[model samples]
Target: MSTVVYLDRISKAYEKKIAVKDLSLQIDSGVMFGLLGPNGAGKTSSIRMMIGITMPDSGTVNLFGQPFTRESLKRVGYLPEERGLYKKMKVMDQLVFMGELRGLDPAVAGRRAHDWCERLQILDAVQKKTEELSKGMQQKIQFIATLLHDPELIIMDEPFSGLDPVNATLLQDTLIDLKKAGKAILFSTHRMDQVEKLCDAICLINGGQAVLAGGMREIKSRYERNRVLLNFEGDNSFLQHPAIADYKDYGGQAEIQLKPHANAQDLLREAVQKATIYKFELVEPSLEEIFIRTVGEKVDA
Candidate 1:
């Protein structure tokens, strides 16, 4: 796939502090990409550069295979982490105004805004002032504004905040639909679970640098610990065997890590002989666990 967004040796710094340091990334077309990191890790600064909100102090940003320019901004939709709406304006009117800013005709914007409000199950709030609606409804309204312009690339920062489970799922489904339509989407968030579910690729940053970046499955497989979780219907004394490098008992089940030199078959054979092993399968680390391990190790050292 062709690159939709590319950052080459991008560096952004304040007067006395470096916010992002020599970061480079390539985001491809028709994929959902995630930019993840802890607070103050420069995820926001990097994204700001991508969308032209701020320029990199050095290096280049390319959007949609061209040099970043004012015209390119029309093809992009941005939902910032700090959401704002015209509190006194009716929901539909505000959405239409936002769409117009993105180059849509006023009539077209109004029609699209109404359609989106209905589709998002907030038709009743069409005429209500934005401040009159609940926070979740306002969030949906902002999301509608983001889509009403029909941009090719949608950039969302913390899209799930202030949303209930049902609404969050609704937004997830909407994003999936957009992906199916071949729109390149990038969202920055701290919610690892959502990233695990929705993103095709991810770039994890720490202290202003990209620490991990790749296809989710590929990244997890690379970090595999070669361990298995097992549950048996008998005594758990076999977990103490020397063949198990790391073992922990959790209620009726045990998580076992075999030594790199030891054969997994030997351990399974011993466990089967001693107990009726019910669950036995290699386990991959969760994104949260991987994040903790990756960053924690650096901090500890």
Candidate 2:
């Protein structure tokens, strides 16, 4: 099926507090869909419902073209933000156990676990017990366990948590490769820059409701690029142009914010004539900017 995960007007609440309200989105194979929001924005609740960990108070969830079921979970792999490895168990054994629980044969599970460890650069720690490994190492072990059975729909919540830059990059590259191999991935993280770099589509949830959802290009295209980056060696008189709303000058560099319906081309023309322009280009609103503007609050990310 083209759609891997579908949430149709789903809502969830606790006691008298609303967690999520009428949230909806879709994930398709071969794309890393980012689930984004500020803290307590209903991301965790939505995910719990999506994976059958909790039922939604209203609406429906579909997985792999069918209604979500306990059995359907076998086709999905999840690595939650909370680590749950058995501290006493050897890393290799833990991964194999998780794989078997997902219905993989023991031998196959062991083989796949070994390969994943090597790929994740954690093979040397295979025989070590979970407690002996560093947090980063244990995190990699958990990552390996999540993928050991080779699931079709992969859900990683804060996957980069507790990982070093080098290891985080390794996991990111591996996820990209899995996406290329037709695995549907849903990434939930606070890192907007990483989301912008890794995801083609995104859903920004605030107060458990989807404030924005669409392909990255389509969503970004909807916002006007009113910010400009200019590097010049001469007079910065262009910063005072009528089109300019405000500006920040840093020596030869400047960040100019334009007024609504202002013409960037008009400002560029003025800048070129007034200074020896080294770099003159309009900068699009970053995902972080879009997030803050949409929710009207600063995201913890």
Candidate 3:
């Protein structure tokens, strides 16, 4: 796939504080790229620079293989972390207006907005004022507005915020379909589980710099599968095995963290000897674990 967005050593600052520092990453068509970071870690700064909402103090921003320009932004759709909507306007009207601002015909915009609302299960709210809708419903409206113009690149900041499980799944499946249709999607969210599920590649930032960047599988493969889940009855003395650094025992089930470079086989052998093992499996470190390991802090998500 062709590169849809590219940032070359981008840097940004406000007053004495550096918001983003020498960050470089690229997004390709049909790929879902996760721009992940802790709060105030420059994720918004980098995204703002990408769509010309703000400019980087150093390095370059490229969209569609060329220098950034306002004209090129027409092909980009951005849904910021802070929601913006005309509260008094009807939901459908607000969506159509947004579509028109992006160069869509008024009629085409209306039709698209209707179809989107139906697909997202918000058709009933289309005639209601934006102010009358629930936060989750309003979020879905903004999501529809983002895609109304059929932009080639979609950037969403906390797109799933305020969404219920059912609504969140609806949007997730929509994004998957969009990616299959060749749209390049870049989203920044605190939801590591969602990122792990949706993103093909990711750039993890901390302190305004990239701490980790690469394809999801490649990055995960770099970390050892040192976690173990065991379910057994009888004696639980295996939890004291030397190979295990720590573990939580819940009577018949245990979640274990193996010591660095420790042999999991040794732990398993010990467990079998002490208890009747029903299950023993070595699991890869989850994305959240990797995040805490790299960032040295637990994610609030």
Candidate 4:
């Protein structure tokens, strides 16, 4: 795949504080890439530099095989983390205005905005003032605006915020559709479950740098500890099976850590023999766990 966006040695700072330092990454075309981190980990700063909202103090941002330029804005859609919408303006009007800002003509923008409103299931709210809509509705509206111009790259920050499950699923489906249409997407979010479900690749940012980055499957495989989760209904004493060396109880299930060469199936066999096993499966570390392990507990300034 071709590189859609590339950041080479990118660095950003505000006054005496560094936001991003020596950050480098290449986003492949047509992949749903996630930028994940804690609140002040520079995810937003890195995204800002990519979209030309802020220039890097040092380093290069290349968009679509060329230096980042004003023209590239036309091919990119940005849904910022900080929500911004004209309070008094109608939903349709706001979307149209945003499309125009993306260089689309009024007629085309209006047409596309209408289509987007319908697709997002918010056509009925088109005439309502931005402030009149519920938080989830407003989020959907902004999401529509981001894609109104039909850009090739969609960059989003906290795209799931203020959204209910139904609406969030709608947005997720829409993203999948966009991916099928060959759009490259970069999103920053704290919703690890959503990231695990949606992203093809991810970059874990920490302390102004990437602590971990790679394809979802590859990263998970690399972090696999050959652990197993088990649930049994019979005697609880069976959990004391000698085969399991490390265990952490999580509700009804136990996260059992197997020995270095201990076969997962062997452990399961022992577990079943000792108790009536209700559930037993090998598991991979969650993204949250990986993030904490890789980034550590030190808070960045």
Predicted structure with the largest lDDT when compared to the true one: 3
For 147-179, candidate 3 gives per-residue lDDT tens digits of 998889999999999999999999999999999
User: Tens-digit lDDT track for model 4 on 1-301?
Assistant: 7889999999999999999999998887789999999889999999999988899999999999999999988889899989999999998888889888888899999999998888889889999999899999999988988898888889999999999999999999999989888899999999999999999999998878888888999999887566777887665665566667778876567888766666777667666776777788888878877777677744432
Which pairs of residues collide in model 2? none
Off by over 4 Å in 3: 297-301
Candidate 2 Cα outliers beyond 4 Å, as residue runs: 234-237, 248-250, 297-301
Best by TM-score: 3
In candidate 4, the residue pairs with backbone N, CA or C atoms under 3 Å apart (3 or more residues apart, or in different chains) clash, namely: none
TM-score of candidate 1 against the unseen true structure = 0.89
RMSD of 3: 2.4
Per-residue lDDT tens digits for candidate 1, residues 1-301, read 6788999989999998898988988887789999988899899999999988899999999998999998998888899999989999998788888888888899999999888888889998898998899999999999998888888889999999999999999999999999888889999999999999999998888878888888988999877465788988887777877788888888678878777656677778888888998888876767877788777775577
Q: Which stretches of candidate 4 lie over 4 Å from their true place?
A: 242-252, 257-262, 297-301
TM-score, predicted candidate 2 vs. hidden true structure? 0.92
For candidate 3, what is the lDDT?
Answer: 0.94
TM agreement with the true structure for every prediction = 0.89, 0.92, 0.96, 0.92
Cα deviation at 107, candidate 4, in Å, is 2.1
